[model samples]
Target chain A: MVRLNNLQKEYKGFKLNVSLEIPEGCVTGLIGRNGAGKTTTIKSILGLVKPTAGEIEVFGKAPVELTAKEKQQIGVALSESGFCMIFTIEDVIKVLKASYEDFNEDEFRNKCTAQSLPFDKQIKDFSSGMKAKLRVLTAMSHKAKLLILDEPTAGLDVIARNDILALIRKYLEEDPTRSIIISSHISSDLEGLCDDIYMINDGKIILHEDTDRLLGNYGLIKVSSEEFETLDKKYIVASQKDRFSVTCLTSEKQFYIDNYPKTVIENAHIDDIIVLMLDTSKEG
Target chain B: MKIIINNTSMVPVYEQLMDQIKQEIIGGGLKEGDALPSVRNLAGELKISALTVKKAYDKLEEDGFTVTVHGKGSYVAATDIPLALEARRKAVEEEFSEAVSKARSAGLEDDEIREILEILLEDS
Candidate 1:
């Protein structure tokens, strides 16, 4: 399990304050816009970035102070980093072999072949999808209890994204107590894979909820000004309006449907929730 | 049993799976004592999160429509004839109430709704 307690990082102009727990047996998704401090948060957990304030504990120990065995228990696939672009898959194997005690070269080779990742080409010559695939393959090749993935599916086609998601599922299957923290711009990926999700904006966690609760209960109701005025405002978590009508977010969809028979309610998808919740003007 | 899930559908994926599996049990497609696929296998085959399958299985077990033996797997629970009939009728009643709500919103009178229902029933 991973826990972040009032986790704050002070930079020259930006500050990050986050607090969340990735349970022992679930995928915890982190979603945010570019520069929303998603990478900073992941780096903090991995101890790649030093945080001026806050505690990050991975499996009850400080990430940076974790022993080599503890460190090897976690798998990481950072975007546009980790693996050198000039290195070929052969070189990657050699490096990983020397780095981790439990690196499985045969499994790595099979995964590369299964995913159609060519070993002959350097990482620089690989397509964006291939590069993404290699990062995931390398991370999964080792028996890691926790996988910290940042934008593992970004810039890839649908098939590649699916392959990565499937691999994540396989990793979870390998151990019942395994956990993962994945950040991505793709809301659908979180909607599909995550047990819980956190939305970050301005370097802070804005929303955290179980994926099922978010999908099942979150709703939006678009109504005219008069209708919006008469409706119960207590249910509104956030609201956005233009010239057309006001869209009010309700935490419970079925509650409104059962009580407000006249109002038209729409299911709130994660993407829409992100847009509405991240809208500083409205969410406030 | 086969279950189809539409990610874009308004209904949540686990809810869709729950309904489909319940229907299968009611229709005898999934026989009593027949073993269901492991959660991991089902999730992999469906290309969905294993947590979703776990949620659905949990809901099913809670509702007494399915039974899960730890270290084994889930199976359709045996139901009495009266319970099976009640399950079928309840499913129909749920759909009927939704239809009635829609008809009322559309300004259809009871008589008109009954007439359309009659015609549809005769065709079927």
Candidate 2:
């Protein structure tokens, strides 16, 4: 379980102030465009960066004050290689074993085998995907109750990505008490895995809700000019006008459908919602 | 066994899973003690996150149609569903009502709605 209350992390030209919760036993996606402060928010949760304001709690204890034993229960895999590139896989294993109390050699081996990485090779010789896998393997082999992955599948082949995701799913299944925060630019990765999603823009959370609920709540309504005129204006969210007619996003598609008998209603997707929201914010 | 997931059906993937599984159970395709695919397996097949599959599985377990044993797997439960068919029918009927209500509000008549439904049904 993770809770962030009024969290604010400041930079020279950007500020990430988001209040969110990743409930126990669920994968909560942290989604945003490039430079949307998604990585900053993840860092704050991991205590990699000190917050300028607000508070955070991971599994009921402050992330900043977590003991070494508590740290073993948390796994982190950032996009970049946090390990020394010169270290061989076996050496990294030894280092990690000494670093965490719950580090499992068997699990680490299984991870290497699952990812098909050569454990004896130096990390510098590994491809980007292999490096990312090694970082994840190291983090997950500790049997951490909560795993934090920041763009863990950014540049991997489909097979590799699926393998990693399957491993994470299996890892979570090992314990009912486990949770994960997967921050990724790929919405599809989050789609099937996350129970809820947090969409941030301009360093602020623009939307946070159960994934299914968010999808169910919004839809696209296309209408002829005559039908568009009959619909209530209050239900319209975003509208595009042309010489012919208008298209709009609506939260209450049923309301408009019931009223404007000739309008078209289409189910909207998460991607559409994100683009429309950002566009609206920019215009506003 | 017979799962209908309209990818463009405006329904979420998990909901599609839930509906199909529930229908299968009610239709007797998935009997008591039948093993459901592990979340990972189904997710991989669907090319979706295991989380989505888990959502459907969890809902099934919560509704008493399935039971998940930690580290083992999910299995259909042996329970008295005296009205399983009735319940499924009602669930579907409600969806139809909602869809029709929305369509009618947009100026479609019952016949027009039926035509669309018939087209969708034919496609399926």
Candidate 3:
């Protein structure tokens, strides 16, 4: 399990003070818009950045002070993390094998085969998607207990994105003891995959809940002006006005379904809830 | 296989998947006992949800149009789906007739509507 107790990281412009727990045997998606400290939180967890205050622990050990053996148990792939530009894919495989004692060459080769990345091709010659695939292969090859990826699919095409997601699913299936933390803006990727979602905004965790609970607890209510006026304002979390007003993305979908018999209570998608909860309307 | 999906189509994704597969089978592109791609494989290919593909596959199996074998895969059951298919085809024909009449009332000639449909069909 990964735990961050009142973790605080201060920058000239950004200060991230996030507290959350990522349960094992599940995917925890860290979601937020750009500049919302998603990457910073990931960096802190990986020990690439020093938290000014609070505590951070992975598998019950401080990530920064982790021994090489302990470090080998964790796999990290940040968007900007890549091999030396001049190194060929084969060279990367060799380097990773040397770096981690538990590296699985066969798994690395299989991933390379699946992605169709030529092992002899230099890293600098690869497309963004190819590079991302290489990073994924390297990360997975280490037989790590925990996998942390930051925007690994940011610039990838649909095929490549699907391939990456498939690989993650396969990995999870292979090792039930393993856990993953994926930080991305793609809500669909997390919708079914994540056991829990942690939404961070402006360097703080605004909400954290199990994926099923979030979906079950919140809903989208579409109503005409007449029905809108009858809605209890206390239950309303957020509202948007179009030709009509939609109110309170609540968890109890059936409450509106039964109470407002004539009202339409559509399922609230993860993206809609996040966007509404963040309430960009309140922002400049 | 001759298949099509519309981004602007009001049809939900699961229904679209089921319809496309049915149309492909009826068009003689997907034969009986043919092994369809796994749920994950098809979802990856279609750029949609795995759950959505599973929903379509579940409906297909429940209707006896396909059979899923655990630890093996999903396959087209058999070509003995006439009655169920005829009902679906008739529904489509009824909807198409309404659409055509609506087009006629909106000032579209038969030849013009055909040309427009041909253009739309060509893209898929």
Candidate 4:
């Protein structure tokens, strides 16, 4: 259970402010484009960066005040620069065993071997997929109650992503109270993994929706200027326009489909929604 | 026991799963009292969100197609034969109407469409 109430952070020109909650027993996806403050938000949650304003609470306490025992209950796998590259797998294992109270060395090594990662080899020599797996393995092997995955499948092929996803599902099955906050540029990954999704852009929270409702109800409508003028404006959440036509994103696709039967309604995917929410040229 | 889905199609994945499961139950492919896979198992097998699988399962339970015990998994429910038959008939009628409309839109005459159906029925 993670909660952010009016969380705000300032970085010169960019201001990150989002109010969201990751409920227990669900995967919450934080989705955004590059430089959209997804990493900043994750960092705030991890206590890696201090917020300029507002507040953040993880596991019912400030992230900074999270005790070592409490920290053992959380598993974090950041995308950029995981553990020291110079350390060999065995050395990293030893360090983790010393670091966390609940660290299971045998489980760690077995998972490493299961993923075909060589224990004798240094992390610097490992491939991107291997490194990704190692980071996830490191985070997951210890039975953490909350898993914070920052692009856990980034830069990996389809096979590796699925393998990691399957492992994540198994992890959830192992406990009923566990939760995850996964941020990704890959919409399909979030599409199949998340119970809820929060879209961020320009350091602002644009959309917070249940995955099923978002996918099922939201859609895109491309209509001429005349049609746009006559159409109801209540359903348009975001919009883009050109001289010939206007493409508006609507969360009430069924209403438009039934009432404006002549209009063409297209299903709005996570990717399309992100694009339209983040990119604003001509607002309808 | 198995459901295939087209992600690019208009139908939502959960709805697709619900429809396929209902059809399977009605067709007797999945018999009454048969156990459905656990939510986690199905999610892993389909490579979809557990929440999506949960949604489908919840809809099935709500519609009386399945019953789920809290700790245990879900099972196909014994159907009310009359209601099940009505549902099947409605589904068939909807499909037939769609096909007839498609044929009509393609410029086929009513007699031609009727003849095609009669020939298919006879051949079967």
Candidate 5:
């Protein structure tokens, strides 16, 4: 549904050069720490920021070149922006109805009521969770075929985060062909939702893997310096040394499980990958 | 069939899913010709990617545990009962062998390990 070919964007110091493909009916996750160029990549896809070089295609056309109908097919809920805070829920609904031809006003209103968002109060008066829900509800109300959600669950409590994630799941379940690109620092959010994951760091695509393969194959092995010295480094992708032990990241987890019976091996979670894969040190 | 995923398990989600479905079929919870839930439905219910569910279903079909008819979803395969039972017995025997080896490593004599197994069998 979306494709980026060597998409590059440059600021004063940081440069983002990423190649990503979001196939139809797949939910792809973009994960990284703050200032890791996640937002830059998202902005480039939305055509909110002009790329310094390379190409981005949303629905087979440049995002900026998309027709009005094509634009309506893409739902966007940016992290730091939404409707005017002064507008009440009713006002926002009116704006949505005016903006999109397919917007379902009654369904949107019912969802807002179900979420316990008061219609009379301005959006600025709503809690963070309430505002977040409104943004997602608005995005889904138009029956968009693709959703570009940036931190939809950011800053929310666990319950709130689960609720938002459930909403996204419901949206996908409604249409099996729909696709989404969700960007978040929250690994758990992406872990359950995305089919594939892209790890970005220092304005570059560091790793891309299918979520299933990642959970199945990636592992972290902790070994003392002596054991580390004897350990085969063929499967080790990245490693770091602490004062007492060396932590190694390996993609061939089953190799170590079969050969190194005495070594401590743990499955690598997304958070572990973020830390270990993003580490600048090379495997020794 | 109820499918519970252990998020913290070292096993992959698709493998865990395949195991649960296999157990259901073997234990008679899922009988031959029973239609499995659609991949999208299971994925939504489990809050996992549909691709993962599809992978498990594909693997089950490949293993002759299930059969897929295009657009009709998956169904428990009409497996050979005696062969299935024999496979399960072999799996149990392997488990016992592993347990006995561990017991021997811990310095337990053959008689002690046999006694423990008898006692566990009586309780079961």
Candidate 6:
């Protein structure tokens, strides 16, 4: 549903060059730490930021070139941007109703009530969780085929995060063909929701792997320096040495499980992947 | 069928899913010709990617535990009872061997491990 080919955005010292593909019926995650160019990539895809080089195609056309009707096919909820703070939920609903032909006012209203968001209160008075819910509800209300959610669950408590994730899941269930690109620093959110993940660092796409393969194949092998010295290093992707032991990241987890039965092998989570991948230590 | 996913498991979610479904089928909780939930429905219910559920369903079909009819969803396949039983036994044997290995690594005697197994079997 969306494709980026060497999409580059330059800003002073920070440069983002990423190539990603979000196929129809897939939920792709863009994951990285703060200042890792995730928002830049999302903005580039949404055509909010003009790319310094390369191309982005959304639904077979450039995001900037999308017609009004074509633009309606994509729903967006940006973290730092939303409706005017002075506007109430009721007013926001009215504005959305006028803006999108596919907007379902009843669904929007019911969701707001269900979420316990006061329709008469200004958005400025809403809690962070309430505002987050409103943003997601607004995005999903228009029946868009694709959702570009940038940190939809950011800064929310556990319950609030789960609620937002559930809303996204329900939106996908309503239409099996719908696709989503959810960018978040919260690894657990993407771990459960995304089919595949793209790990962005600094300004480059560091790693891209299917969630299944990542969970199944990636592992962290912990061993003392002596054990590490004797260990077969073929599968090791990255390793870091501490005072007494070493932690090695390996993509071929099964190989180690089969061969190094005594070695302490832990499952590599998204957080581990980010940390170890970003670690500057080399595999010897 | 109730499916529980352990997010922290070393086993992949899809594999965990497949294992659960296989167990349900073998234990008669899920019978032949029973229609499995649609990919989207199960994914939503599990709060997992539809692609993961689809992968499990595809693997189950490839292993002859389920059959997929386009637009009709997936259904439990008629089982070869002996073959299914053999597969279950093999899996249990592997688990037992791993348990024995772990017990040995923990410095348990062979007799102690066997006694523990027998006691567990009697309780079961």
Choose the strongest candidate by TM-score.
Answer: 5
Q: Which residues of candidate 5, in runs, are more than 4 Å off? A: A281-284, B90-113, B119-124
Give lDDT tens digits, candidate 1, residues B1-124.
6788876565777899999988888778988898887887777677666677889999999988889999888988886636867867999999999999999999999999999999999999
What order do candidates take by TM-score, descending? 5, 6, 1, 4, 2, 3
For model 6, how does the per-residue alpha-carbon lDDT over A59-127 read when each residue is reduced to its tens digit? 989988999999988889999999999999889988999989999999898998999998778999999
Per-residue alpha-carbon lDDT of model 5 for A207-270, expressed as tens digits?
9998877788889999999999999999998888899999999998989989997889998888
Clash count, predicted structure 3: 5
Which CAPRI level is candidate 5?
medium
RMSD of each: 3.6, 5.7, 8.4, 3.5, 2.7, 3.6
Task: Give DockQ for candidates 1 onward, in order.
Answer: 0.39, 0.31, 0.04, 0.44, 0.64, 0.60
Mark the regions of model 4 whose C-alpha exceeds 4 Å error after superposition: A281-284, B81-83, B90-113, B116-124
Which parts of model 6 are misplaced by more than 4 Å? A281-284, B86-117, B122-124
Pairs clashing in candidate 3? Answer: A217-A250, A217-A251, A218-A250, A218-A251, A219-A250
Q: Write the per-residue lDDT of candidate 1 for residues A1-284, one digit (tens) a residue.
A: 89999999988889999998987877889999999889999999999988788899998988889998789989999986868778999999999999898899999998899989987888888889999999988888788889899999999999989989888888877776778899998999888788789999889988998887787778888899888888887778887777989888889877788888788888888898987776744446
Error at A184, model 6, angstroms: 0.7
Task: Provide the lDDT at A230 for model 6.
Answer: 89
| TM-score for each of the candidates | 0.89, 0.80, 0.69, 0.88, 0.92, 0.91
**Model 6 agreement with the true structure over B47-118: per-residue lDDT tens digits:** 776778999999999999999999789999997856988977999999989998999999999999989988
Error of 5 at B66 (Å): 1.7
DockQ of 6: 0.60
lDDT of 4 at A57: 92
**Which pairs clash (backbone N, Cα, C closer than 3 Å) in model 1?**
none
lDDT of 6 at B116: 93
Query: Per-residue lDDT of A1-284 in model 4, one digit per residue for the tens?
Result: 79998899999889989999988888889998888889999999999999988889999999999988899999999999689999899888888988888889988888888899987889999999999999998899788999999999998999999889878877877775689999999898888778889988878888898887787789999999888888898988877778999999998888888888888898888998887876652242
Candidate 4, pairs of clashing residues: none
